[model samples]
Target chain A: MNVVEVTNICKTYPAFFLNRVSFSLEGGKITGFIGRNGAGKTTTIKSMLNLVHTDSGEIAYFGMPLIGHETEIKQRIGYSTGTISWYPRKTIHEIVDVTKTFYTHWDEEAYRRYMTLFNLDESKKPIELSEGMKVKFNLLLALSHGAEVLILDEPTSGLDPFSRDELLELFTTLKEHGVTILFSTHITSDLERCADNIIYISHGEIRAACSKDEFMENYGQPGDTLEEIFLRQEREERK
Target chain B: MNALLKKEMRLSAMLLTYLFIGFGLMALLPGYPILCGVFFITLGIYQSFQNAREANDILYSTLLPVAKRDVVKGKYQFVILIELCGFTVMAMMTILRMTILADSPVYRQNVLMNANPFFLGMVLLIFGLFNVIFLGGFFKTAYSIGKPFLIYIFAAFLTIGLAETLHHIPGLSALNAFGFDHIVLQISLFLCGILIYAALTWLSYRKACTDFDKIDL
Candidate 1:
């Protein structure tokens, strides 16, 4: 079953537009939403989450319209944003306390375990924590909710090499537990390691969608990295 | 709604401390009959503006399995909760100041001044103003499509100014004098103010939910 299905979604702004974008994430699979900075990847995610209004289109989660089924849809999904900010004064424990009221499947033991693993001091305010720690905190909250689907936007934008590797391992564990993941990022290395399916978006459109093996077979060379293939594809699309 | 209300109440508690300090300083002066009233009014307006600036936090909030209307309602309740808390604190301080000043010989000569109705009138006026300010501000913040603080300030200044001017009129003075002793009239006006606020709150919630539905995020 598809966890998310977006069709013919469009949203126009002054300088950019999301034009008739469509995609889907299957249950028990990790899908990477790949696009350049201005390719409307975030816009597409926002539309699917109903954060912004679409010009025209249909979006469904578990075969139900997202408009009326927001509560049900959100209950089964965990979401994090790239640029979203948390209150500076709130400690991780306080944030967790508040968030616990919203989700029925919240796992206190899992949350505490992640806190220990991430070395997150629940007493420290969010502003006092490093960017990597903040990201880890966000991931912990999403995961501890026991959500069936995780929708992360640029979840690894500012992390050290060690932290990035640990996050990938965490994602693997999540996938093994039957949780589907749909994440967007400019970091192709992370996607290559963690994503099973790829949705390549460029210029507000889906340039390609395929499995990781197919993506590698279609564009790979002996020494070509995913970044090189992406650059080459972007250059060809500009012509 | 309870979670959101709790959050707002906590924020209100923090803001109320600031308001009390300011009001306490004003109480030190003599002949400040309207200080409590103006304080509550200004505090309500300020809280509404601050809420508008922080509206983007709703992106994370809306992720919960709650209706958009509930989110908007939660916000409106927060504003109202702040207004009530601020007013209650101000009222307590006013009574305290009145008792302190009444015991002092310097203020005995001005005992009639102490009986000024402006504080009560100001409370009613501020409650009405807060309703209007919150409704206008929330609509702008939710839509992400307008100047929320500007609308709030304009409405607040206009209503307060107009109400103050009309209260000073000769004809309105008679209505005010009669209302001082008429329990029914006082109760009716109070209820009217509350009903108007409730209606505006509902309207704001409906608009915000519709706006959220349209948002692409």
Candidate 2:
């Protein structure tokens, strides 16, 4: 079953337009949503989650539209836009404790597991954490609610090599547990590490959307790395 | 709804509660516009917006397991809750002044707004305008706070100046009446103030919720 399906979503700004963007995340698989910074990856993700209002679209989780089911859908879908900018003065324990109150199926076990794995200090405020720790904390909040699907935007952008590898490994582990993930990033190497599927976007349009092997096979020479395929595709678009 | 409001209070409005508590005592001042007390209370509430913006609260909150409208509802509820708490303290002080200090020269000879039903009425009016002007302006963009609040400040002081002078106008001296001097009229105006505050605030809450619904966050 598709965990999330975004169909014909569109948004427009004074300078940019996301044209009829559409994709879906298969249940329990990691789909890397890849694009350059301004190629509408964040805009598309936000549109999917209704964080960015769509000019026209239908977004469904478990086949229900987002408009009326925001609370229930959000409870089941973990979303981290790769930033923890709220409650800078409050402790992690304080923010997470309060956040858990909003979810019906909060998993204490998951919370503790991430807390231990990330080596997070609950007493420390967000300002006190390293950039890596803040991202881990953002993921912890997303996962603590027993979310069936996790949509992370640029989850590894600011990480050290070791931390990035750790997160990619965790994404693989999460996939094995049947947690569907849509991981958005420009970091192709991180995607190469674990993503089973690829959704390539360029110039605010989808360039490639397929299984990882098929995406490589269809878009570029068979042995090309994901980064090579992306550069080639972007070069073609600029032609 | 309870969860959202709780979060707003615990995280968003934490330190600001002391502002509400302390400013209500501004009602006890012997000779001040006293309406300016209401302005300061509104300013205190404005500080919550500053903190929320700095923390990017609207972004985090939209991701929570609550409807987006509920987020706005939570904010409005918390703001009104703080206002009500301050109003309660102000009311207690007003009652004490109306009774114990009824004939005290310190209050009687005071040349500014008195703590009375009429004063309380204007307080509600100022609060009502805060909701309409500030909150209504805020959710239109969901991020900009300065211009809207500046507009509110202007409206607030204008209302304050008008309120202070109303009692001095011919046949309107009853507005500044001392110790039940015009108890019936004062009480009626106070009731009208209550109705106006409730109506205006509820309308502003609805408008804020609507504006927030269209925001991209």
Candidate 3:
């Protein structure tokens, strides 16, 4: 069963347009949503989450429409953006205190565990944290709630290598626990490491969506890395 | 809804603090009532403009487990709460000042300036118009605040200016004096202001929900 099913979603901006994009994520699988800058990756993700209104399309979670079931769907799906700027003056503890009120299934013990694991300072406000720390805090909030599907947009953009690896491992553990993930990033190495599926988008259109093994088989030669495949795809698309 | 309101309160607590201080100061001035009213409405508009500039509310609230409509509802509730608090604070401070100056007719004269029901009604009308225009323009796109903020400010100043000028005219001044004498007329005008406030609150919420739903974050 698919965790998320997006069908023919279209959104138009003055300078860009996402034209009839469609993709589906299988349950308990990690799908890498790949696109370069100016490639409508964020727009597509935001559309799926209904953060952005689409011009035309249907998005569903667990076979229910996103429009009518937005509150329910969002409750079960945790989302994190690349830039994590909440109330600048709010401390981490205050933020968590306020945030936990929205979710009926909030796990305070899991929240404390993630805070300790991430070494987040509860007394510090968001503005006091470095970009990487902010990202970690956001990830903690996302994980604290019993979210079944995590829609993370560039969740590791600013993390150190060790922390990034730790987060990647955490994603694997989540998958093992039957939680699906739709990870968006331009970093191909992260995708190569753990993604079971890849959804490539370019110029506001979906270029390809398939399993990582099939992606590598179709595009890679012996000793060719995921980065090489991404570069080759970029070069091919330019032509 | 409670969750959203809690977040908004936390986010805007500093603004509310500043407003409380500003209103407290306004009540001590000789031109207390009208200036207090002006400050009250301006504070609301200014804080909303500031929120739009920050854009953090949109970022955080949209990520939460609430519908777009609830966000709008929560925002309207927040604004109304702030306005009511401002009104209460200013009213209390003004009344306290009035009590302190009971021995001085000159001070009482100053207190009576713009203290009539017609003037109070105009203040309410200005606030109601500001909300209708501001929230209507704001939620239409929910992106840029400059255009909407400027549009509402222009309308607000012009309306307030015209209302004040109209109040000074000979015929209206007579009506104002008449309203000041008759308790029933004064009560009726105050009730009219309340009615407009209630209608605008509902209208603003409805408009905000509609406009917010169409917004692309």
Complex DockQ, candidate 2: 0.79
- Residues B1-217, candidate 2: write the lDDT tens digits: 5888888877887586556566877788888878787887888889888888888788888888888888889888888987888888899889988999789898899888889998898889999999999988999998999999999999999999999888778988889988888899999999999999999999999998888988886
Sort candidate 1 into its docking category.
Answer: acceptable
What range of 10 consecutive residues in model 2 chain A has the weakest lDDT sum? A79-88
- Report the number of the highest-TM-score candidate: 2
Better of 1 and 3 by lDDT: 3
lDDT of 3 by residue, B1-217 (tens): 4777777776644564345535534544554445445545555546754763474777678778898888877767776766666555555654454355434454445523444455456556666766777666677876666676788677767865675466467665532332135556656876797789789878887988988887776
Cα RMSDs, all models: 3.9, 1.2, 2.7
Find the 10 residues in a row with the least total lDDT in model 2 chain B: B13-22
Q: In candidate 2, how many Å is residue B82 off?
A: 0.6
lDDT of 2 by residue, A120-229 (tens): 98999998887878889899998888889999988996889999999999999889999999999888988888999999888777877889989888887967899998
Compute fnat per model: 0.51, 0.80, 0.69
The lDDT per prediction is 0.69, 0.87, 0.77
Separately for all candidates shown, the number of backbone clashes (residues 3 or more apart, or on different chains) is 8, 0, 0
TM-scores, in order shown?
Answer: 0.85, 0.98, 0.91
lDDT of 2 at B102: 87
lDDT of 1 by residue, B1-217 (tens): 5976665444222454345434423433454444345544455445544543453446656777787667666666766665565556555654554455445554443322232234444454655554555454555455432355466556666655554455366755432332134445545655665566567656656666675555444
